[model samples]
Target chain A: MTTVEKIKPLVLIVDDNSTNIDLLVNTLKKDYRLGVAKNGQKALDYTEKHLPDLILLDIMMPGMNGYEVCGRLKTATRTKDIPVIFITAMTETAHKTRAFEAGALDYITKPFHTAEVKARVKTHLSLKKAREHEIYIASKIQKTLLLGQPPRDINGIQIAQLTIPSQKVDGDFYDFFKINNQCFDLVVGDVMGKGIPAALLGAAIKSHFLRVLNELIRLTDKKEFPDPEKIISSVHSSMIDQLEDIETFVTLCYARFDMAKYLLSFVDCGHMRTIHFHADSNRCSLLRGVNMPLGFPEQEPFKQTLVSFQPGDLFVFYSDGLTEAKNQDGVLYGEKRLVDFVQKNAIMESKELINIIRKDVVAFSQSDIFDDDLTCVLVGIEKKSTSQALSDKAKLEIKNDLTELARVRDFVRNFCEGIPGFPLDNNRINLIELAVTEVTANIIKHAYGEHTGERIQINALLLDDKIVLQFYDWGKAFDPKSVPLPVFDGSQSGGFGLHIISHTVDEVVYSRDKKGRNCASLEIKL
Target chain B: MKLSTEKIGEVTVVTVLTEVLDASNAEEFKTATAPILKESNKVVFEISQIKFMDSSGCGTLLSFLRQLKSSNGNLKLCRVQEPVRILFELVRIDRIIEIFDTKEEAIKSFKMGI
Candidate 1:
């Protein structure tokens, strides 16, 4: 009548001998709650109804022997861990071995001593408790280790990552952190192998990255930034030294970006490709450079490449897991599929892009569990609108009037006012004004002198760090490249205007419009 | 950032102090440490400070160490940081280079030198 929690460990006794069952019940009742069954079938029924921590079976019971009952109990996962001990009159070693082989934890004699019965039961239960405790601790450790929170959004870039391990943990890790107002560093890597060993190595790599980044931050704060190449190389060496004992390595890609400069530099350590999408041109370029994977015994030099990115451009970096994911029919998802998915989902925000890829990969594999860990990061450069370029009222339309020089001067002043932190030196400012005047005068004197009906449009785009001045005119096409090198013979007056325009700007590009008109574009880096 | 040293038979084991060295100032460090190279052809650089290093720094260290090798003495590195250690592995610097993690171990390595 004791409560379930207070009741002693339950012992089930199955025997055909009424006297033996009664004796066992009386002997163990002080230390345990005892259940009796006359046959193996009844014993199984009793076990299914009221689970016991231990079982004592009589081998020679009629209609289903102890061996069959023990086998059935062990096969059922719910009752499998319950300790079974056989009671037999057979004194042969082989018979005892058979009883032990039949999933019994121990064997007791037919006329068991009360103390002997209690000792065997207590020993097996303690061992079982210890095993269960070990399993519980292992599960707790695994849960704590595998738990990961998604990356937070900074500026317009949103990052989310998943590392679905084939075992308790995976070897993939990623990091996204800001270096400055216009610079951010991103890294992702996969250690060779999987599971606990690789995961531990992965954690080591993560720690190294954090340490290096902290050093970088300190150096930056101190205004004595170290060369990024050296930092990465040192990180590689440290990782190699740490992982040397494991006979494994890591493949990493490190990239740093300057949003203000619109430049990105990256180094690849035998990682997969990094994709660059030019939003304005709708073109995609893949960066494929190789260095030895970390931990190799050779010192492969790391190379850093710089790329210019405009607003609305996208940079996508991913681990091979995405391209290597296999479909149900054993067809790999492949690089082409990944590229296509990105292209189709390019307009989506970074978070949405990741979800789309994840959904597609899951649907393609036809399984919720991925064969390999999946990780993807997309960095989107938000485009500034034309209104943000410069004020509409500040825009000037060049007219055919002969006395519009004052209007042009007013336009320059307003244009400069519209741009924040304009760093125009006196010489450059004068040069720009002279170039504008010469170009406009040339169009007026040569192309539109007699034709007042023709209209010319000039637009100025104020970018994140530079200003682009574009001149569009319905005038006849003229190729500047075809323009003869003007012989500037010590300040010749008329012909040097075009020469001045070419030298005064950073870059000048000319293209013919579809209507056979002329368009001249100039870029000035700030 | 950790500093520890060991001595073996007039050879001084100096542990390196930094995680990564690059083109920015690696050449200067090489220049400053040249006196140690001159003092003993049998110098063991315990490179525990460097976690990462680039090719320029690696090249500088290799060229200096190789100079020591030509004098029938040797320059050794020990306890290489992992990332910088990777550069040595990629270039197979370990094959020709003697590296150890402990000063006692690296000093012991010098006993069999040519």
Candidate 2:
């Protein structure tokens, strides 16, 4: 616990000879904490409890040889990464090769060279530490750069994403950057390579895209988003020579989402064609482009295409890793199966639908291991156009009494659930139920007074970002402002209903429509 | 409201067998619990069944506490649902009302007399 107690790397020495154990203990004790095992079984039992950083194993013993002991250690997941060096009196090439077959990293033939043993142990320990540190840095970079929090409140857009960066993190990236209040960018890219070089290049290319965006932003108006085409073309022009030098090409799909206009402008550089599903007609279409991958010899200027979407539409952007995923039969999962699945399941919530697709892909592959990053981004059009009505008006007439409050809740539920693509979650539904309850109760008690025979009509108006509930009554018009705020400490009972109505819903207004009917409308935002 | 009362010592535990305690059933709940309140000064409302409660429903519980306090008695609530508890906390009624996670804790509070 204290700084004086410096922790040492643990080394387990497995040798039957007393002289060799003595030499190994003396050489390693100064740098590492040492554990000794006289025989192979003792070594196995000792390792079961204590996980040494490195093991110096002997090749010959009475019951088990060093090769068998090392092989057993390699088989275990817990001790597999621990470096094992065989200590053998037999200097034959066959013996040393056998040690390597048993998973020995290096061998120190006896009449031990103390300096060589020390150097090998130190190098292996540092290598293990460096590997662990690299994984940690990769995870951190992936969390902050590759994966981002998508804007959930953007009206008309519901996005669900799944990206599993492999342990080695081979060059699969997805990123989101907000341009302005009305626009944001979603980009997914894949570096056509593997391991450390590809991962580094992928991270470099991702940040390079950001640099290009910033440079373009300075040259253009601040309010307008940097064009997706300009951004992609710039990245291709800058990186093409370097990529060709390295013999690697990067495929990218750069998409700009205009929140105010409900449009998606994108530039595709030889990436997989994004799938567009029309929930209204149950049809799926692939949106593809003609540009080559970033590093191709024949580079073409990037072309940006704009697409407008309506309610109940879905767009799915994916990696080739998805469609090229091979099962035990060695057949690709392919685009046709994915399209059919999305067409049938596009009407569901984005999270649920994306999860189903992810499960299907994983199942079809029959293994979690993938050659590349398994990634996909699904965008669901959640709201109707601002100028257009979502559907026919939903209205319900009930007796102006406290007992009829349940009917009002059912009307709200049926109205919301009946819409083609309602984006309201359960919590939102519960809040609406409570708000309507308070409003209807106030109407029955104040507006109608003791007139239980009077009937009240409620209309549900669906909008782009919110739903408006209109409660019409012929009784005296109720004034929402006249009712004071409810005392939170329970001192005032009169304003509790009004306080609930005002706080639970987004907006509440009381107005007298033409023929003297009191209309109390509550706007509830999704 | 199906009100079932069980007497533990001088404390009476009444469980309301209903999911909602909003404006629609606030009056029914008050009327149902009235006989139990008359029988026991120390009453613990086991409201695990009451899943939904708005401001009006919360108001009824506060009124019951006032009624009990006037007669030098106290009211406790236990097994409160998550939504109902949120409503009470939102209105700051949790400070005024004695709320506990279990019926035994509520009855113990009654015995503790604080």
Candidate 3:
């Protein structure tokens, strides 16, 4: 093949005798590009500058002998993989044995055989390429495991997660286990170190935890989910002996959420604290756990903290990879930034919120790949179901008829029933019922204007010691501000409708919503 | 709607016997008690039996009070229960009417006229 048409494999030939170098160069020059180094020092320097496919060295040199050169090359990470072959005049078995002891792939006797040299070099090169290909396939398999599809919504909790592994494989792992319809357990963990060993340890811990959880579920006669603290303690105690022998430990956070009671119980085994954002009050707080990392001598019992979560609440579980993420200028994306981002975007859906944060981190760090595994899990309690709903809010839709007014009144009455210290008495219920009825009657008369098939939706929520009622209608909208208060001097007959409604409720508001629908809301203080 | 009337000197004390005075029966209550307002210039409504009331019920009382005030007389409420009192204060209707804890106290307010 012409030199310009085909790329050639590089081979370095090192020797003190010019005649011996000429012999090997002539034999290998046609098949490979040749680089010559007369002594051991030049050979090492040439390999350092440009790695070659093979090196042929003479065992006897004036300074820095071939055996010493091969030993030094094998010690370095960069040059260790270069195949080395020794050439010597001594055909004694001891001399050849010494050459092999110093890290030679093979030794050539003085009467050089060209066929043997070519065959050995070709065999070792093919073997090295096959090993590299195996590593590439292994990395691809690990990536698929890291990026497995996770369900977006589990029960009433919306979940969003992201993991940006730093290498082909990672030392971080996260998983979710569904216990029942109303409960599930989730975990996020980081092994003690990075690379292949850490990755394997992470995999082992995950599979072991899953097996134990399923076993506990199977052994139970009564239907009860495994407690997070119990699960952590069991895993830690079981894996402690093995981990200590390897001189490594894992930091993990395991949590279980009960949708029926809106409670989240979790234990942190030397992991980062979990952050909670309360939608009711628009405040944020950290939930901390007190325990050593798994595999350490049990300093304290693994304690779980129980928190009452409400609808529209957010819980953020993340690894140190996110907190220690550095920008181009080497500044960390710390806790304050994360907290502030969550506070501003708490109103967003869980997936959208996570995407925004992920994008921001990427932009701030100025790189798509992180220096460590960037792992985060966001859990959000969706707004409660409004139909048959008895939480802080109740919503209902009905036709624009006077008969539907009674059901609306009942809806509001049932919502006001359990509010502590509020006006749930008979007279108060009647007053609220009357006020709502009057407002509905007006909407049916003026807004709908005889199209009784149209619908009106009402949503009631209790906030800040006041019961706020929101009325939504798709009919013709009107501004309550333009409507003058009726004259109650026993002269005006028909305008008393709005007067009675506005006076009975604490506050009244009227505006058009984003969908171009009329929204008439009222609030009554407890 | 049930009602019982007794003459307490110059004031007629008409007691509401039904526990509720709401839209379901406020019109009947107004029709049934029309003669009581005309029977005496000064009247006292004994509402101790009223456990629930609404805007229509409040309108019924306002109509009677207006009729008495035009004739240089007054209408007063007595034995107003706590829940009904809250409804009155919430709507600011309590500012126009005099409320008392007992029938004797309400009747005395009109008789003394101080």
Candidate 4:
């Protein structure tokens, strides 16, 4: 077999003097792929097209000095991570400090020694390689830990979540557990440090969640859900030593949603404050408790607080990457802005709400790249209405006046009650009523321009375990896409109508009937 | 909409006496109640009779909240009906304003300066 050739790491050399260039090149050429640039500008131009594994730059050069070149390289995303070593004839300590301040990884003094050059270059190159390997491993571990999928087909809760693993330091995780038909649990965790170590710890914490939970299940009654505090306490005890060794901690928020009891009990451990959207008051509040992040030995025991929620309530659990995101002005996106955004868009479906929130955060920061892991989870409380039986169909008619809204609700209530064995609860019926009222209001306000003497038709397609409501109006045809996602301009206008309708119903489809009437159909799965 | 008012401590507990607080009477209720509660900084809206409410009605409450806030005063609610209460929650207006389960609690909150 023919001998295989090793691919040497590429190195770029920049020097104004050809003699010095020749000296350095002869020393490095034997072990590296060498690229030569006579001036700083030439070196920058070379780096623009080709990325070298290492850069040896001369500080004293005319036309774009090496300090300027190294600064530019460190500022650029593509070249920022490339290791840059400076070469200079000056023996002053100030020059060396300036070189470092300009982001030079290391510097070589004047009058080059071939042995010293070889040793420094070899050591720096190996250090760069080791760092790259660590990042690669860290990212791989983060990806593996993020393999969980949010549970599906929950009766009364809508969950939307996002996770973006970072290149440098990343350790963000979220998981959902189905405790029973009437209850569920959600936990979000983030390791405080960056890079490979933090990522590994995050993975470890995620692995421990199941072990701690299962042990509680085994030791206690199987019929009951594990307590949030007990599970977190056990996880902390097991992971504290490892965390202390690493000098880092994990922020965790564990919440249990009990649908039957209408309670959300949670234990917050040094995580970002969880946002609570109260459906009854049209308000948002930050939820936090007195507990240190995991690994704090002096911390009080984690305590769970219980808060009641009605249908249409919402919650947002996020990592620091979201709230701590910085704009060009260095202003943090901040918790207040997030609360406002959530309050404005509270009527939206959870998936749409979270995706828009992510987009908003990126837009506010003016960049998509994050130095830390970005993660967020949204939860919306909904009505789990059960009907005793199904009906084939139903129909109703109403005037353009807003007074007709009450009549519309009555019609829906009667329709659901008329069905045998229909699961009609206060929460479920409330949602259908709200959706119907919202659409009718939109028709009167936007389509009819709030004029009187207008009439509309309502038809209900009561299928198996679902209801589809259709509304027909002779008013102007409307483009649903024209409406922007909800933002509070302090007005009742904008997309609140569409948001509420979409949030309440499983599906909303708008079409023009054969009779040229505007038809909007909304479906709710039982 | 019909209106009834009572004074418990420094708080004026106003109750809407009608079942419907919709577009038909939202503007009227806002206009009539704003003057009577103008002299007091602490106001409690005990609206249990409002079994049905629309967005305009909710807007009326918010406008009053802003008005009270402008003067360094405050407003609260008590005994809101379920349907109307859920309506406020969906729009998140309850966060801007405080709601109490009882009128006495509302008055007590004003006394406690909460």
- Best TM-score goes to which candidate? 4
How well is each residue in A192-260 modelled by candidate 2, as lDDT tens digits? 876567777888898788899889888988866668888888888888789989999988898887755
lDDT by residue for model 4 over A156-247, one digit each (tens)? 67889877655575678788888865678898888887787788788788889889988899999888767898888898898888888888
Model 1 misplaced regions, further than 4 Å:
A1-168, A216-221, A386-526, B1-114
Whose DockQ is higher: candidate 1's or candidate 4's? Answer: 4
Most lDDT-accurate candidate: 4
CA lDDT of each candidate?
0.68, 0.80, 0.78, 0.81
DockQ, in order, for the candidates?
0.01, 0.27, 0.10, 0.11
Q: What DockQ does model 3 achieve? A: 0.10
Superior by TM-score: candidate 2 or candidate 3:
2
Q: Evaluated on chain B only, what is the TM-score of candidate 3?
A: 0.96
Candidate 1 chain A: minimum summed lDDT over ten consecutive residues — where?
A487-496
Shares of reference contacts reproduced by the candidates, in order, are 0.00, 0.40, 0.12, 0.12
C-alpha RMSD over true interface residues, each candidate: 25.1, 1.8, 4.1, 3.1
Rank by lDDT, highest first: 4, 2, 3, 1
How much is A523 displaced in model 3, in angstroms? 19
Higher lDDT: candidate 3 or 4?
4
Expressed as tens digits, the lDDT of each residue in B1-114 for candidate 2 is 898999999888888898888777888888988887788777888889887777678888888887887778988899987767766766778888878999888988878784
lDDT of 2 at A135: 57
Query: First chain TM-score in every candidate?
Result: 0.50, 0.54, 0.52, 0.65
The digit string of per-residue lDDT tens for model 1 on A436-466 reads 5546655655556678766666777676667
